[model samples]
Target: MPHKVIFVLIDGLAWQVAHDCMGHLQGLCEAGRASLYRLNSALPSLSRPLYECLLTGVPPVDSGVVHNQITRLSTQTSLFHLARAARLTTAAASYHWISELYNRSPYLAVRDRFTDDPALPIQHGIFYHADSYPDDHLLLDGEYLRQRHDPDLLLIHSMNVDDAGHHAGYDSPQYRNAARRMDIFLSDHLPGWLDAGYQVIVTSDHGMNDDRSHGGILPEERQVPLFTLGSAFSHAPEVAVRQVELCGLAADLLGLSHDKPRNQELIRR
Candidate 1:
């Protein structure tokens, strides 16, 4: 099947929250429409570390993205880097740090930061707006770029849920409302993607506590949901897998041929 994957990273979404806020997710699991598993995030359970882990298939000890404290991570063997190396198109709707990570690649990176830099190499597609963008904004912006640019691998990172979690507590109605908003985006988009030979992978980087803070080894912070749904794995049954294994699964989805030395090391870790 000719299939591509659009992986959506919902920040600070817990598995427990999925059943509560994202009822669509629970419906998918119960109806066997998707394989939903509780996967563990990398320790520290911070955003940057989990993102690096998802992209590089590396651990905090090696990547040095131990926390938000660490600034830049010269990650050369990540998904974007590998996609560029193999001549595949890439697109993302994310913040400045993520755009900076794609500086070397000819990517359709839409920087959704507060500051707008008109001189950025990739200008036409860049989105420099306020920090008040809702959770569904990521999906809407990503859908725009994918329809316009048709990137082979697309990433849309939603930030509002995490923000709500931090400000209004993880279990607060505000956080649930944000997840519900994203649910509408998924409902409207995912089924069409499935029919059109596209994989829709939705998961979170970490989970927040009731108190609305993260950055520890607590189970609430360390475990999140992982779903692989599309024509690529339509007949695949549900199974338990490591969080890092997702990196390999993504490469396989993209038909990426060469695994860099660092990726090879991922197999052993």
Candidate 2:
């Protein structure tokens, strides 16, 4: 069994962005025999709902997190809760909304504190405010959490690149620069976990378009990249190959069973 599982959630990251900034990730894809799985987000194509889907293996309607705000859940099952039930130490550091959804005890969470929108929901956990473009300071926080806490599961959410791409357009230099910076983080900061024997899963909630506007029900907005690295998986399965279910991917990586009642055949190519 893999000692650690690290989920790296890059917000608003599209396949094109990864293709453009492929150097850092490319090596991992090659070295660890990584694979890319193209998966679609839920309808309306927002962050919160899709993230819920990724974590719980349930859709927005089932998870009761259709939008960015917190809603009453009929079944309040989360990946963190499940991990804890299995006696696994879990931690997450995300932008704002996600941290709120999974902010429970023993779960190290860091909420982003750069938002001005009051209507936006509040997230609990280990919150960290980003002061500038490249919040490289997160590296230190991530290291601290991994070394000191040594959580069995650690999730890192980077929004600087996503915010830049949304505002300045995905094709702009700002987005490219943000991607490069993210690459640096992965190349420089993440390998420590690998050295310590962690299974790293890098993915996105959904992809963005050149205009940077999502929620349009388009493939670019719905389809995102899913890459897995470490000793758990041997090969980076081929692209244009069979499509893997997003929720199933998460469940498989964590050694959990699929909890939803959907047509699992739909995702199989």
Q: Estimate each model's TM-score.
A: 0.83, 0.79
The lDDT per prediction is: 0.68, 0.62
Q: Model 1, range 43-80, lDDT digits (tens) per residue?
A: 87888777877777777777877876555644547777
Decoy 2 TM-score against native: 0.79
**For model 2, where is the 10-residue window of minimal lDDT?**
115-124
lDDT of 1: 0.68
lDDT of 2 by residue, 1-269 (tens): 33467878787777667766857887766664555556666665677777777776677776666776553332456666666666667665565456556553222333243221222222112445342434466555556667766777776777777788787876688877887788887888666777788877788776676777776677777777767677666453453422224445444556655463323222222
C-alpha root-mean-square deviation, each candidate: 5.0, 6.2
Model 1 regions more than 4 Å off:
104-131, 234-238, 258-269
